[model samples]
Target: MSLCATVPDWQSPDLEVFSFFLKFCWILRMPMPTLQTGLPPGPKGSLIGGNLAQVGARRVDFFLEVARTYGPIASFRIGRWRLFLVSDPELIQQVLVTDARSYIKHFGARTFKPVLGNGLVTSEGDFWLAQRRLLQPAFLKAKVVSYAPIMAELTEAMLAKWPEGQSVDVAFEFSALTSAIALKTLFGLDDHGDRVQIDQSLRLTFELLTRRLDALFQLPLWLPTPANIRLNRAIANVNAVIDSFIAQKKAEPPGNDLLSTMIAAQHEDGGRMSARQLRDEAMTLYLAGHETTALTLTWSWYLLSQNPDAEAKLCEEWKRVLGGRAARAEDLGSLPYTSAVINEAMRLYPPVYVIGREAAADLELGGYRVKKGYTVLMSQWVNHRDPKYFPEPERFLPERWLGGLAGRLPKFAYYPFGGGQRLCIGVHFALMEAAIVLATVGQKFRFTVDPGAIIDIMPQITLPPKYGMPTTLMRR
Candidate 1:
C-alpha cells in the first residue's frame, strides 16, 4: 500500500501516528554530527528517501516539530531536494524582502502551473512585474472600499437564508457567500450559474494536484493514469467555466469589475493583455480572491464560537459602532475590535499558512550557506504560535491585538497575508471583505459549533477545516 493510504485519513490519528513512528525509526539509526558541513540541525532521514516519508501527511505538524527541535534555522531533505525552514523574523525579512530578487517561488508552487497557468501566483520575472503593475490600481484601498456596498448586500442576502436554530456547515456557508461575492466582484455575474461546476472541478483539480505534489516520483501528465485522467477532466471543466465567463465579459461594455479592469488595463506602450493572459489572470483572481476571505470568515466564526467572550465583545462593538446597520466601508476605522478579532483569527488559522521560495543563487541566511535550488519555507502556522512574540500563543485573545500590538510586532511576526515584494495584491480587498462580512453577520446572529463535530486542519495549498465546521445558527 502507498504510504499515503497507510494513514486512514486526517480524522484518525492512530494510524498516522503509527506510520510516522515507523518512518521516524529510520532517523534513530543516524547520528547528529555537524561534520563541518555548516548545515543547520534537523532530523536525520532514511538514506534513500530523506525526510520525505517522515513528513507524510502531517507537514504542518512536522514543520512545527522541525522548528521547535532544530531552532530558528533548520535543514532537512526530501529525496535529493534540500529545504530550510526560516523561523527568525529578521532572517525571514531578509529572504522575503531585502534579497527577494535572488529567489523565485519554490518547486511546490510550480506544481500548480498546469491549472493556474502563468498567473501572478505562479509567474516570475519581468512578466509578473508588468501584470502586478496593471492589477495594482484595482486593489488599492480606494478602489477596494468601493466594493463594500456589494459585499454588504451579498452578505445580507446570505444572512437571510441562514436558518436560525438550524445546524449548518459554516465552512460551506462562508464559501458560498465568498463565492457569490467573488462572482459578482470578479466577473460582474450575479446568477452564479457556473459556480457549482466550477467549485466541483476546482476542488477535484486541487486534490489531485496535491496528491501529485506529495508523491515520491511525479508522473508526467501525458502518461495515462487514473489520477491524471481525473485531473485532466477537472481542469478541462474549470477552463470551460472560465472561458464562458470571459466570453460573457467580452461581449459587454467595460465595467468596474475586476475582469473588466484586467481586460481594459493598458501598459505604458498601449498594450493590453492577450487572451491567454486574461484567462490566466482571471483564473488566478477567481481562485485566490475568494478562498482566503472565505477561510478567514470560516475560521473566524469557528474561533468566535469557541471563545464566546471574544464573540460577545465583537457583537458589542458592532452594536455601538454601526448602531445595528450593516457594516459600511467608512465604518472600518471605527471597528477596531472587529478588525482585531479577524486579525487574531487569521493569526491562528491563516488561510495560506505556509509559503516558500527557492534560492536562485547561493546566499547567506542566518549565517548559514544556502545553495542554489535550496527551498526556504516560511510558515505562518509555526511563526504565529511562537511564544516570544505572542505570549500565550495558543490562546484566542483578540484583546492582545487591541492595544497597537500589530504596530509593535515584528514585520514578519504576524504576517497572515505574507510579506515583501510579492505580498498578496488582494490584501486591501480581503481585509475589507472580511471586516464587512464579520460585522454584518455578527450583529444579527452568532454560532454555537456542534459539540460533536471533529475539527482539524487539512493543510493543503490553503489551510481549511478538515471535516467542515458544523454549527448551530443562534439568533442574537
Candidate 2:
C-alpha cells in the first residue's frame, strides 16, 4: 500500500493525547536544547501557540517582518515545531541546491497529499526521483513548445467573449483560460462538457485545500466536519475526472499529449506507473500546471494596468513581433518585453510565494545549527522584493530585465519558479504559455483596473488576487 493511502487519523486517542502533551509543553516554554542554543533571533511568541496566530493572520507580512527584523536567518516556534526562515540567497542555494539532499518536503506539503496524493510535490527520496525521471520527458522544451498553439488558441477564444469597455474579473477569466489550455495540453480533452466539469472539480478541490491551509488545527479525514466532507467530495470529483481520462487513454493508442506520454512511460526497471501513481502525477500536473500560470497572467494584467509605461512597452513589442496576429511558439524569443513583463509580475507576486522544507538531519544553515525535524522556509515574496537585489524592488519595472540584467542578479535572488532539482518541471511550458497568451490577448485588448476595487493577495496553494481583479477590457 502507498503512503498516501494512509491519511493520518488525527482524532485517535493516542494522537489527541500527543497533541495535548505538545501543547502543554509549549505553554510551559520548555527549554529544549534545540530551542535554547545557537538558534537565530526572532520575535518571542505566546506560551501555547507561539507565532502561529500571527503567521496565520498574515502569512506573507509575518514572514517579511521576521526577515526584516531578524536579518537573513530567523527562528520561531509554533507548538513544538521549530521553523527557520532563510532569506539570504546563498543560504537558500544551500538548502535548495548545495546541500539539498539533507532536506525533504516539509509537513506543510503533506496538506496537499489528500488531493495531490504522493505526487512529485509531496513525495520524497527514491519514489520522487523515479517519478520525476519518468515524467520529465513530457515537459521537455520540444514537447512543451508544441503546446503553444493550444495555449494561444484558448486565450484567443476567451478574449473573444469579452465585451469592450465592460468590467470583468480578469482573474476568473484567466483561470478559466489557463484551465482549458491545461486540459487540452495534458489530456487532449477538447470537449467543452468535460472541460467544464473537470475545471469545477479541480477548482473546488483547490478551494478546499486553501481553507485547510488557513485552519490552525486540522481534523482527521474521517471526521464528519463540513469542510472535511466538502474536501472529500471535491477530491472524489477530481479523481473521477482523472480516472476517466486515464481509462480512455488506456483503451486507445498513445497520442502526443502528456496523458498519452505518461501512459507509455516506463521506469528504468521496465515497469510502468501504477494507475494510482498516474492519477497522482496527472492531478499534480493539472493543478500546478494551470493555477500558477493563470495567477501569473492575472497579476501581470493587474501590474500592467497599474504601470501604463510597462503596458505600453509590452503592446509595442507585441505589435512589432506579432503584427496583430496571435503569438506562436517561434515568436517567444523575439518578444523579450512580453517575457519581461511576465517575469516582473511573477517577481512581485510569486504564485508559490512560501516554499517549505524539513531538515532530514541536524545541520548547519546560515551560520546557525538547525536541528533535525525543523521546518525551513524560503519566501520568494520577501527575496524578490529586497532592495539589495532589485533597486526600487516594489516597482513594476519590466525594463530591468532587459540587457542581461537578470543574469547579473545573485543566484536564488529572483526565483519565481523556485530553484534546484525541485524547480518547477513546467518552467519552459509556463513561460511559453504565458508569452503566447499575453501576446495573443494583448494584440486585441487592453485592461484597465476597475476603480474602487481592492485587489489583495491570498497566499494559498498559489498566490491569487484575494478579491478577484476586476478590470475593464478595452478593444485595441
Candidate 3:
C-alpha cells in the first residue's frame, strides 16, 4: 500500500523522463481552477511571471483596459497567484462592504508594516477592532472641528511666507505645511526644533517607502543596500522623535492633543496601549494624517492651474465668502465651489488610488467563481473614471458635484475616502482641512504652472507630481 511502490523505481531510466514531464506540467500549469469550467477568462500570460510583465508598469492603465476589454470582473495571474480586478460598483461594494469579512488586508498592506508597525492601518481582527474603538472618540465631529483653527492658522502662515510673484514648488510647500499641521493637531508639537526634525524624518521615510512600494522587485529589508540603509536610518529617526514625545507626555498631565487623548484611553477590560503601541499609533497617524492631504492639495493646485476657468470660479467663491479674510471652520459650508473643485480634483487623481485585499475563501463575485487565496484589487483610479458613472470622464468639471450629484451616484462609484467599516477615520478632518486651506490660500493668490515644466504622475504611495509642481503665485 506504500505510495512509493505504485511508482516507477528511482534507479530506472524511464523514471528520469517521467520526472521531467511532471516538473514541466507543474511549471506550466495555470494556478486557477481547472480551465475546463468555473474561473473567469483573462489574458494569457507567460509561464514564469504570468501577467506581471503586462500589468506591472502601468497598473492604472492596465486595470482600465482589463475592465474595458473583459467587462467589470477581470481575472489575471501574477506568477502563480490568481488576481481579480473588480470594477463594477456593486461588486466592489461586496468586496469592501457586504462580504468584507471574507477577506483580509492583502500583501500591499504588509509593505507598510515596516513603517506603520502594527498600527490601525496594518493590524487585523480583534486588535484592529480594539484600536478603532479606542481611537473613535478622538476623531468625533466635535473634536475634529476644534482642529480647524489650527489648520486655517497654519495655512495662513504658509501663504504669508511665499513671495508675491515667485515660482515655487507647490508640492513641496504643501508637504511642509501639512506636516506642520499634522504635528500640531495630532501630537501638539509646536516647538520649532521638534517640528523640523520630525518633518525631515517623515519626508525621508515617505520617499523610501514610495520607492520600495513602486519597485518591481523590492529587496529584503535586512539587506545592506543603500535604499535599505537609508530606510532604516529614517525609521530610527522617526522612532526617536516619537519616543521622545511619548516620554514627555507620560511625565506630564494629559493634554487636549490626539496623542494625550490616546495615552489616556482605556479598554473595557481596563487595558491601555503600551508604549510600543502608542508609538506605532502615533507614527501611523503622522504618516496617514498628513501625506494624503498634502497630495490632494498639490494635485488640486495643478488641476486648477491647468483649468483657468475652474480657478477663476474658485477665487470668486473665496472672495464672495471670506472677503479676503482667513477662512474659518464656519466658512466651509459657504464656499461650495471651492469644495467642488477639491472634490473634482480628487476624482481626477485620488491620492490613495487603489484599495487591495485578499480572498480568504472561495466566493462568487459578479457571477464569476473566484477561488480562495486570490488577490482582489479595487482601484479608485479606474472606477472613478468609469464612463457609465461619470460622463465625459476625462474632463475636469467641478460643477457636476454641485447639486447632490455625488450622493446620487452609486455608493462605491465615488469613494475618494474608501468605504466600509475601515473607511478612513480622518475623512472629516481631511475634507475640513482641505477646504480651509484652499479657501484661505485662494483668497490671497492664484498659482499658475510653469510652462516649461513637465509634470508627470508618480503613482506610488500617493499620486504626486513626479517633477514637483512648479508654479508662480499671483496676488489675486
Candidate 4:
C-alpha cells in the first residue's frame, strides 16, 4: 500500500465537529489548543516563552535551581503552552501510578507516532492497556531468565574486542553492546546481524527525534528547513527498517521472537495491535531497551573507574561469586552488591533524567495547584539526589543501597526504573541484564576515565553524558 493511503483526508475533520478527536497522524493542520494556568514561579526567561530561551544553556543547573526554589511544582508558559513542573515523588506517584489515567502524554508525543507508530509508549486509553498486556508475558521473570545467558554470552564477546590500555568511549561501546543483545534475545537469536542496519539507524533516528521532540513547541516537523528535513529523513529511514521487519515477520510461523509474541497477542475484546501499533511498540522497546541500559552501563563503568576502592570491592565480589566463570541469571541473587553499584550509578546519572506528563484536570501537588492542560514535569535527577533521602547525594556510594537505605527511604524516593504503573516494564529484565553484564565485564576488565576529559551533560530524550566518557580499559 502507498504511504499516501495510510494518511487520512484531514480536511474532512475540519468540516466535522469531531476535528479534535482525529488521530494526530493526519491532522497536523489545526492550531494546537493552548494551555493556560498551572502553578507558581521559576526562572522567567523571554516575555514570549518563559524559560524557553535558556533551555539551551546549562539546563541541568536551571532545572536544579527550579527544584530547589519551587519545592516540587512550578508553572511556566513556553511559546503558546502552559506547563506545570512537578518534582515531588508523592505527586509523581499519584500522576504516574494511582491517578495515571487522569493524565495523557503531552502532544509532543504526536511526533513520535510518525517515527514509532502506535505501540505501548504512544497508545492511549484502551489501546495502551491492550498493547501493554500483550507484550507483558515476554518480559516475565522466567522468560527474562532465559535471556540472561544471551546477555552473558554477548558481554564476553564485546569485552574481547576491547583493546588493553587504550582509551575508548565506554558510553558508545555499551550502547552498541546492549543494542546487539536486544536484537539477539528479543528475537530468539544468538547472533543479531540482521538487526544491525536498524540498530545503527536507531542512534540517528533518536538523535533527530530527541531534538524535534524537545523543540515541539517551536514548529511542526513538516517545515522545509535543514534540521526538520534531516529529522524527517531519519524518521523515514527508521520507519522503513521497522516496516520491513514487520512485513518479514508476517510471512513466518509464530516463533519465540518478542515480535511474534506481540503479533499474536489478543486483547479481551479480541483486538490485536495493528501493524503500525506493533511497529511503534517495537521501536519503543528498541529505543527504551537499548539506550537506557547502555547509558546505565556507561555511567556504571565511569563510577567504577573513578573509585578504585569501590571497583576493587566490585572485582572481589565478582571473583568470589563467579570465580573466573561466566555469570548466570540465578547467580544474581548472591550478587546484591553488584546490583547496588549499578543502582548507585543510576542514581547519580539516570538514563531518563526528566520524565513528564500533562494534567488531565486541575490538581493539587506539593503546595501548588495545577490546571488542566499544563505540562507536569518530574525529574529522577532531582528526586534521587534530594539530600533528604540520600545523604551526601553527590557521592557515588553503592554501600548505601546494600546498607538498608532502600528500605529506610520513602516510597518513590529513588525510583530508578520510575514508579507507579508506567514504571519501566522492563525493570526486571534490565536489572538482570545489568547484573549479568556488569559481572561478566567486571570479571574480565576494568575501566578508568581518561584524565582532562570534560564531563558535560546533554539533556536529550535521555541525559547522555554530554562530553561522552572516554576511558581506558585494562584487562583483568
Candidate 5:
C-alpha cells in the first residue's frame, strides 16, 4: 500500500489537488543537450527560425514534402525553431535506438498536454520513468489477455447493429468502435452517461488539437474562436468528469480495470500519484488507446474492399478456420493471414505516419552536419513505402508479410509503433485488440467501399480518412 492506496478511489477533493499543483507551479525545466552546428543541407528560413511559414495549414504534410526535397537529412527554421527532417533509416535508428537518451519528443503532442497533464506521454524526467515502471505490470501478456473478452463483446455488439447490404462509413464506425472498446477495457464501463461524457470530451479536445495544428503555443487558450471555444469546453467537460470519477472510485472497493490498477499503483520510493496525475494518465490512456488503431482498421477495411482477391483470400481463411463462428483474441496466433493483412495495410497507410524528435545537441548524422535547436522527424509514411524495402509499394500485397520480406526488411524500416525508449507503451495491447477486432468484424461481414466515395487523407494527428471510408456490410 502506498499514496495511491491512501488516496480516494474516485476524484480527490479539489483542495488537495489544487494545493499540490500550486506548490508545483512556476518550476520550469528543460533537460536539453548541446547542438553540433553546420548540419545537413536543407531549405532556408526567414527570421524567427522560419516560425511564420511553418505555422500554416497542412503543417505535417507540408513538412513531409520538404523531407522529400531535402533528402534524408534536412534542416529548416520556424521563428528560430530549428526543425530537422531525417528520412534515412540508419540515421533514424541511431537517433531513436542507438543514442536514445540524446533526444526528446518533438513540439507537437499538445492534445495530451492538457488532459494527461504530464502523464506518461508528456513526462520526460524521473516522474515519467517512475510512472512507466509502475504501470508496466498492468499491460503485461497475462493482463492483456484479460482485455480480450471485452474486445470480443464490443466488436460483436457493433457487428450486430451493422445493417447488411447497406453502405456505412467504416472509418466512422472504427472511431466509435475503438472508443467504445477503450472505455470498456480501461475503465470497466460500457455505454453510460459518465462514460459517454468522457468519450465526448476526448473527441472535442483532441479533434481540436489535430485541426488547430497551425495555432499551437501562439495564443491564449481561452480565446473565443471556434477552435479555442470548442477545445476549452471539451477540456472543462473532461476535467470535470475525471474529477468526479476519481472521487467516486476512491469511495468504492477496488477492481481489476486499468483505472483501478493505476489508482492502486505505488512506487518503491514510497511515492504515489496525485489526483491530477491520475487524471492525466487516464486521459493519456483514452487518447492514445483509440485513435491510431481506429485509423489502421479503417484503412485495412478500405484496402480489402478495393482488392476483391485479397478479400476473397481473407474470406477463405475465415471460412476454413472460424467455420461461421466468431473469432477470439487467442485465435490471432492461428490467424497468420490476418496479421499479414494488417502488416501490409500499415505499410501503405501507417498510423501516426511521421515521428518527431528534438535535437538535444547538434551532432553529425548520415554524413550531414547538423545544428542544435532543430526538430528531427522520421516518416514511417516515407520509409514504409521506400522501393528498396517494399517493391511496388502502392500494391496491397499481404503475402509480403507472410514470406521472408518482413524479416528481410531493415530493423527501422518497418516501425509502425515507433522505436527507441519512446516506443508506444501500448504496442502489444493495441496489436492484440486490433487483430481480434479485425478478425471478428471481417469474418462476420463482407464489406466494400461505397463506389465513388471520396478517400481524402485527413492527415491530422493520425492519418485518417478525411471523407470517411464508406463501405457496405453484407453477411457472409
Candidate 6:
C-alpha cells in the first residue's frame, strides 16, 4: 500500500467548506464547534500557527495545562496538523492496546530517525515486530537479572572516585556511569569506548531534535542549513562510534552482552539482521537503555535529598538487606522501599514524559471520530499526577506504593515506562538497574542538593534537570 494513500486528502472539497466555515466564524466571532462536530473541545490557538507558539519551550507544562483545563480528550493544532491529547486511562488503553495497529509513531518521535534509524523506537509494521522478537530474549527477566553484577561493579567503580566531602553533578555522574555500563553490558566493550565523543554528539543531536519538534517550520535534513550541517556531523560521530563497537565485537567471540545476543539471534526462518540493521538496533538500545535509567537515578537522588524521611527509610531498607555489601539480584526482592523510592521519583519526574502516535486510519477514540493523520499525545506527567488516583499527587510519597498500591491503580495511570505492546523493552532492565544502583549507592553515600540549586526540568526527549543536579556527597 502506498503511504500517500493512507494520508488524508486535504485537497478535497471538504477543506473548502472548512475554510468557509472558519471565515464565517471569524466574521461573527462565534465559538468553535465541539463534540457534536466530531471534534473534542480545546484551547483556542492562533490562526496562523495554531498552538505552536503557545507550546514554546515548556511543552510538558503546556500539555499538563491543556489536559487539566480541557477534558480528557482535547483538540489542538500545531501548524497544519490536528492534535489530540488523551488523558483518560480507559481512552489511553484504547489507543495504546485495543487499537494499537491503527496508529504509528508521530512526527515528534520520527524526529530522531536521523540518529535512531528504523530501530524499534521509530520503526513500524512487520519489521518492528520482527526486530522486537529477536531482541526480546536479551531483556527478559532471567537474562536481565544476570547483568546485575555488572551494574553493581560499574556503580562501585564510579563511587570509588567520589570522596566523602566532594561535590558532584549527580546528573553528569550518573550519565557517565550508565554510559560505561551500557558500553559494557550492551556492546561487550569492557572499557568506556568513545564515551566523551558519544556524549557530545548525543547532546548536539538531541538539542537539534528538540528544536525541530518546537519549530513551526523546518527544513529537510538534506538541506545544508547551519543546523542541518551540525546535525549531520553529530550523527556521523555517533555512527562512527557504533561502527567501531560493531567492528570490535566482530573480531571477538560472542559474549553475553546484548549486541552479541542480537548478532547471534535468528528468526524462525533462520534470517538475521544485517550490519546496517544491527547498527540501527544498537543505536536505539544504547540511547534508550542508558539515558532513561540515568535520569531515573539522577532524579531519585534529587528527590531523596529533599525528602530526608524517604531517604532514611530507603537507606534503612538497604542497611537491613545489603548490610554493607554490594546489592545483587537476590537482594532486590527484599528491598521494597528501595523500589518504592524509584517508583515515586519516576512518578514526579518521568524520564519519557509523553507518548505520541498518529492515526494511520480514521478511527473512533474516546467517543470522538479521529481522522487519519491526526496525532494523539498521552503524557505520563499528566496522568501520573491525577488526584483521583493519587491523592496529593505532587507530594513525594514513596509509602503510597508500599501496600499493593501499584496493583490497585489503573494500569495506564502510573506508567512511567509507558503501556501496552509498545511499552519500553527496557522496562525490566531499567527498573532492575535503578533498584540495584540506588541500593548500592544509598548504602554507602547520600547526596544533599543545595537549598538554592535552581533545579528545574529541561523537558527534552527525556526530562533532565535544567541546571544539572549539583550535590554534596555525604558518606553513610
Candidate 2 least-lDDT 10 residues: 30-39
- List ranges where model 2 is wrong by over 4 Å: 1-36
Supply candidate 6's per-residue lDDT for 63.
90
On TM-score, the stronger of 3 and 6 is 6
Worst 10 residues of 4 by lDDT: 187-196
lDDT of 5: 0.76
Quote the positional error of residue 432 for candidate 1 in Å: 0.9
lDDT of 5 by residue, 226-284 (tens): 76787888889988877776666666688778888888887676667787889888877
lDDT per residue (tens digit) for residues 21-108 in model 1: 7667667964443439888999999897799876766888899899999999999998778999999999999999999999999988
- Candidates 3 and 5 compared: the better one by TM-score is 3
What TM-score would every model get versus the actual structure?
0.91, 0.90, 0.89, 0.87, 0.85, 0.91
**Which is better, 4 or 5, measured by lDDT?**
4
Q: Pick the winner on lDDT between candidates 2 and 3.
A: 2
lDDT accuracy of residue 24 in candidate 4:
58
TM-score of 1: 0.91
**TM-score of candidate 3 relative to the true fold:** 0.89
Instruction: Report every candidate's CA lDDT.
Output: 0.89, 0.86, 0.84, 0.77, 0.76, 0.89
* Model 4 residue 441 CA deviation in Å: 0.6
Q: Candidate 1 has which clashing residue pairs, if any?
A: none
Off by over 4 Å in 4: 1-38, 189-200, 213-217, 268-272
| Candidate 1 RMSD to the real structure | 10.4
lDDT of 4 by residue, 145-257 (tens): 99887888888888878899999988878877887788677754344454566655666666677666556254667788887787777777778876776777777788997
